[model samples]
Target: MSVENVMTLEKKKGFTLIELMIVLAIIAILAVVLIPKSQIFKNNSKNAGVTTNVNTVRGYLETKVTNNGGADSYLNAATLKTAIASNFSLDSSTFVPTGSSSSEQLVNPFDKTKASVAVADKSSGATNNTVDTVETSASDGADGEVVIYVCKDGYVVFGVDKGGDLTQTFKVK
Candidate 1:
């Protein structure tokens, strides 16, 4: 090959400072967008987990209340957790809803507070939605620190619609 042709054919070496800066800028931009989005998705999963946990607990409550004959029965926070530990497939130590201390306080997926929520039929709707209150731990009450309650005919957490199933949606009142 001719010397001039050889020189012309020499491979380009190293990136221009501008090119490197552009690539770095792109990565930075992607990080900015993706970081928040990832967090949002994580929170969404946690929220959906809240709904699923509430529903599962409600079903167990139904069985417990019914086996005792009638929906007049109820379960308090500690007892309810114990029941869940025994009945559900999770290890007892980790059975409580996640994202908080497992002692007794149920974690709120939406609020990220130690206050846990519960569900049950208050109307004994007899094949309908039982009014359940999403009970929270202390830090949300005048007295400070309360337990979750599920009764035969009253509010449990929030006023759940008597609809057959909850769509896993919520807006803080």
Candidate 2:
């Protein structure tokens, strides 16, 4: 080819640095806008999974309590936890549900420890807002002790730790 023709072809065939930079900038903008939104969706899915699991356990506990007659209802956290372990074969590993706190197992639905379980009392002998009793799907006083706290509004609060923090509350079905 002639020198003039070769030079013209070279000028037309290649992309300028500015055009490449513009493409890169567009990609950067898309990443900035999309990355965080995707992460937000992921976090939301995780949280929903946790809530769904907790509610599922709660529903199962209610069913067990109902089958035994309302007189044998869980009515508290400890009873519900025992019901889950006994009726559903819920082990300490899968029951942990959340953090190190005893209540984490009940509330987090992702903890996997053997921390003590407790429930709120609904009996007349209990002090207000204090957990004073233990209930279970197993026979009463079974070594599987769970503290019980009967809520003022009739919901039972169950926790996993000694302090009774992180309780999951439930209404009688």
Candidate 3:
């Protein structure tokens, strides 16, 4: 090739700084848009998983209670633990939420707050916790948003916060 042509080809071989910046800017914009959406999707998937876990645990409680001779009786945390240990063996005992409090919580699969207890959203007082013998989110009443918890009537029930209301559809009571 001619010297001038070879020079031109070499100069064009790599991206210019401006071109690189433009490409980066476009990628950055895409990341900005997609990152938030991706987070939303992740949170949604986590919420669904946590909801399912709560419901599954509730069902286990129901069957266990019914199968026992107690018609309306329920197991407290202590009894529930005992029953789980004695009767039902979880294949992955690691999946169980261990702590009744943040300090004692185990690895919750969907609790992105990094707490062993999962909440539908952020706040304090709702970290897989119990208050006044009632299971409450860590920040249950602080923000006027009643953070829901899988608490006991001495019996576990399933529910979620629907526009600031604790709503449940389970009819095993």
lDDT of 1 by residue, 91-139 (tens): 3444334433443433445443333443222334354433434333322
What TM-score would each prediction reach against the true structure? 0.52, 0.51, 0.51
Candidate 3 residue lDDT tens string, 33-105: 9988997787566555545544655566567657875523655444454454333232123224342434322
Weakest lDDT window of 10 consecutive positions for candidate 3: 141-150
Candidate 3's C-alpha runs over 4 A off are 73-156, 160-168
Question: Which stretches of model 2 miss by more than 4 angstroms?
Answer: 1-7, 71-79, 86-90, 97-170
Among all windows of ten consecutive residues in candidate 1, which has the lowest summed lDDT? 138-147
| Model 1 CA deviation exceeding 4 Å by range | 73-82, 85-148, 152-173
lDDT at residue 141 of model 3 (Cα atoms) = 23
For every candidate in turn, the CA RMSD to the true structure comes to: 9.0, 9.2, 9.6
**Whose TM-score is higher: candidate 1's or candidate 2's?**
1
Model 1 alpha-carbon miss at residue 165, Å: 19
Q: Which rank order by lDDT, best down to worst?
A: 2, 1, 3
Could you give the candidate ranking by TM-score, starting with the highest?
Answer: 1, 2, 3
